[model samples]
Target: MFTATPSHNGYSKTQSLLHESFWLDNPERPSAKSPVNQDIEVDLVVIGAGFTGLWSALEAAIENPNWKIVVLEGDRIACGATGRNGGFVSASLTHGFSNGLSRWPEEMTELLRMGSQNLEEMGDRISQLDIKCDWLVSGEIDVATQEYQADELQQVHSEMNKLGVSAQYFTAEEIRARIDSPIYQGALFDPQVAVVDPARLAWGLARELERMGVKIFEHSKVIELQDSGTLVRAKVGAHWVSGRLVVLATNAYPPLLKRLKHLIVPVYDYVLVTEPLTSEQRKSIGWLNREGVGDSGNQFHYYRITEDGRILFGGYDAHYHGKAGVKPEFDTDPDSFARLADHFVQTFPQLAEVNFTHGWGGAIDTCSRFSAFWGKAHGGKTVYVAGFTGLGVGASRFAALTSLDLLQGRETPRTKLRMVRTKPLPFPPEPFRSWVIAWTTKSLQKADRENGKRNLWLRLLDSLGLGFDS
Candidate 1:
């Protein structure tokens, strides 16, 4: 392989917080994740070195102090979406209760309630562990750029009341008072969310897990999983790690299991951080408090304020890599980076023409349901978690706990959301993939527009499953 060009789809170290100005940087005191070739064995082998694997290893080791747990990473620590994300601790409620109830056959409301609880627990964990990832507890504002979105919010709000969910709805006047923008028709604010320095959180957890006795191997990629009872043989650079239990935490990488190949769609989410704004400029935007936000359309933008004065913003990008994933785009590519920066400036007139200091992208696993899919692999010996559906921050937090619960032979809240399974997106690879991805993306976008409009005709499309998934 051409290692000379570097891992073509790898993280751009140059654009990381490690190199960002004004503003960049602690991880959770993680052990150095750059360890070289080595062989080691443990009771559990966790694959994919990101938030899920880190937390899984940490929790398992903490529960059984004597058991050896190892985390296998294909690339550097936090190099995945954990390091390159928009940093929002988003909840599963974003898909709305109606969609959840319709798509997920059982306990949709409870699933969302538990989803909120997960965010609360994450807040408590960060506070108790004192893992400083610039944790900011704030509301996430979903604004309607067009009249259609405003209607969708109203309908969702009505549904929330039906479900007895607690949320605050705002009028266009209220939105304007908070931020000077006419583009927004109305907004919904969910307080059960926040932003975090994801890399710092991952690193800190990894370090803590190692200290708690988990044996972590850096260049370790689980090449294959053996189905001999609970025993699994995983491969590293020069090691074959055999363990009593194998937890496949690989979210968006080439799947370790064949059944999962087309199950997870690798959507490329991109992010860009701006150079710190002047104090006055920060106040001018009125988001000076650093609340995270995402738009209310089918395709929307997400933005958050860094601890410093800079704003990080990003959203949908073309993924060209594989069946469900985007092909890798370079960090310095003007097409990708500049396009994102342009969106940021256009969204906020006050910060027009601001230069972005960093740009990066990473693949995230999504299913047709826009939710996670997890269950047994290899006749129940190997367990896995995947299909985060673009809200991995909070979902990953819950995934760790679920993985442990299943390992301990107990039931999890996922049992409530279990009806959500990984189904093919109406086609196979090749032509099927291209059409499905494009049509689904387009259909969802149009459906979102219709919901935003509250147009009867648009609602008809959604009901017919004409534009979006049922």
Candidate 2:
């Protein structure tokens, strides 16, 4: 297992860094829209301007061109997890093939098809709309660093083959020949992943939504939602936006609904991006295809190459601050940055001298099921979805479509799936929540060290189909 010690070889490289999401640090980022200043009435009111909210508004606008849609965001567009991710838009609605198969075996085949189609449509939408956010169908490689992980990945490859999923299993030498990482014991390559400039994608979506006549208001946080006869009214500070239907796409932030409080917990994930690699530096790693890469560990690291030749490294530490909630103060973690830098060097010692330029963190809306779930409230006038668990980039579009189906009372293939119909097991409230998370995290780390052997705690979680991840 990779060491989490802060004093490792690459610690000092994290000293000088821009503490912000690399995707959001762009001169081309669109300016914020006006905030809601007065009571407004619309056919639909979508809360949150992240990918889900934007996609909700976009899809709704495309389906009903005459309907008036308003989007309210607490901060700038994509300022939340939408802009703060590794940008690996995977075609996996259920996190991954294994997780989906384990949780919803009966619907796994259909789910896989839908997820792939969703990704294809998403790419088509981006292309047709001319939204240039570096959309690359570069695929993703899940590398096994340990011998046991290699065996497990090989087993997964065989299962995927039986399921008719197109994937390639590579031996250590074969995998290393592609990426040139010494620790790669084996790899499973899934050609259904894409990487993008996530913040750019969100901004472009917002732009197109506005072009389609969707009213978006940034810095307008919906504090309260109430049922008023037929319409649902959401309070945004001193203002209110009432609509016949309301869609809550507020991921990771405090849910407007009371039941969502225990259903999802905000788990923080950190990231670091290096300065653009020199030609020589890039050649040393031999990652020419720019496929997104992740290690096969309970506490794994996902790293990908940027368009400009830099590497974005993240994952490993899924930190939960209990009842602290989501705060800006938690955006930068020194220990996490140090550990990531150390691991970055450990993975590619040939690029040990590469200096990181950016470091940031964002909270993931983690549920026990480790995938997205939907719910309805306010007498079915409002529908909400959350718990993408860090794989929401591509899934958010599918989530938006599913949420819309639920909101509009449509019985589509998406809404009929058990994965969409069922909600994850609610976490035990408060203090126990913290205790359970701490214990689970410790056990996961121990499993990583012990060749992926599950302890009693993890075994029980597996039995219940409930666990935590980032």
Candidate 3:
């Protein structure tokens, strides 16, 4: 096993990098659409123009070509979590097999099938639409950094084989040959996950929606949502727009529905992107396939190489503000960035002179179960999907389909799954919620340092099917 001395020092080189997301800083980003300025009516009005909402509008429009669809975004398209993530697109709808088996053992088989189909269909859609978003289906490697984590991965590999899932277990030497990271003790490689340019994907989808005659409005925040019996009315500034049906894809932000406040909390996740490596620097580390990599720990780190050869490293400190609100001020955390920089150097010491070009953070819609859940409000006319935790890049497409199924009152195979029908356990209110999260974070850090041994509080939470994670 590899070990290193931990330090709390900050990297002065990171101070010169841009604070914006590297993906969203592209010059190809489309111009924003005009805000909703006049009273309008449509067959469907989708809220929050992130991946989920955009997919919902596209799916619904294709299902019924004559229907008029309108999408309202509080900010520009792809400005939220969709634009600020590590961009690892996973094929697991329940986060991963372990979480799925632990939570929904009976329905895991079908859920896995659907999740695979969703990913395949996503690839097809990208090709058919001809969207050039640096799409790569190179898969992912979950590296074990500790002895206990290696043991856990070995067990997981065995279980996955029994379940007929495609996976390969790599020894420490084997893993080092692939990534050349001293921190890896071993690795579990799954060939289903993909990494993409998330902002480009979101922007490309928005363009497709426009091409299909769907109306999109940006910079139009919905101040209030009311049911008018005949339709749902949304108040956007001086405009009052009504729709026969509505879908809420607003994750992490303050939900229009009060009940969602208890179900979703905005956990801030930070990320750093290095400048493109020189040929010599790249040869020093052998990442031949450029597969996305993540360390196996309670507080893990995920890193992937962008199409431009920059390394996007993120995760490890999931912070929950006291009040749990999403704001611009939370987008930049110097302390978290410094911690990530220190960890990066520890993993790849040969790249000690490398410098990051971008650093940023975003709010993930975290729930107790750490997966997406479904709900409907306004007497079932308004369907909402939230609580994607941190793995929403690919799962958001599945969530979009489920939200449409809920809206149309269709009982398809997806809507019939227990994972789709059930809601995560609500978090406690205020000070108690903060205290529990704080205590859980401390316990998780302790477990990571203590050979993955669960303490009393963590054991109790695991027994009760309740805990906090990102």
Best by lDDT: 2
Task: Give the Å shift of residue 223 in candidate 1.
Answer: 1.9
- Candidate 1 lDDT over 86-164, as tens digits, reads 7888766424455566765357777777888888888888888778788888878888777767777888788777877
**By lDDT, is 1 or 3 better?**
3
Q: Global CA lDDT of candidate 2, please?
A: 0.94
The whole-model lDDT of each prediction reads 0.67, 0.94, 0.91
Total clashes in model 3, counting residue pairs 3 or more apart in sequence or in different chains? 0
- Write the number of the candidate with greater TM-score, choosing between 1 and 3: 3
lDDT of 1: 0.67
For all candidates, what are the clash counts? Answer: 11, 0, 0
Candidate 2, 249: how far from true, in Å? Answer: 0.5
TM-score of each: 0.86, 0.99, 0.98
Give the range of the ten consecutive residues with the poorest summed lDDT in model 1: 1-10
Question: Comparing 2 and 3 by lDDT, which wins?
Answer: 2
TM-score, structure 1 vs. true: 0.86
Give per-residue CA lDDT, model 2, range 1-470, as digits (tens): 68768775556788888999999999998877889999999999999999999999999999999999999999999999999999999999999989999999999999999999999999999999999999999999999999999999999999899889999999999999999888999999999999999999999999999899899999998899999989999998887899999999999999999999989999999999999999999888898999999998999999999989999999999999988989999999999999999888889989988999999999999999989999999899899999999999999999999999999999999999999999999999989999999999999999999999999999999999989999
Which order, best to worst by lDDT? 2, 3, 1
* Residue pairs clashing, model 2: none
Q: State the lDDT of candidate 3 residue by residue for 143-193, as single tens digits.
A: 999988999999999988987889999999999998898878999999999
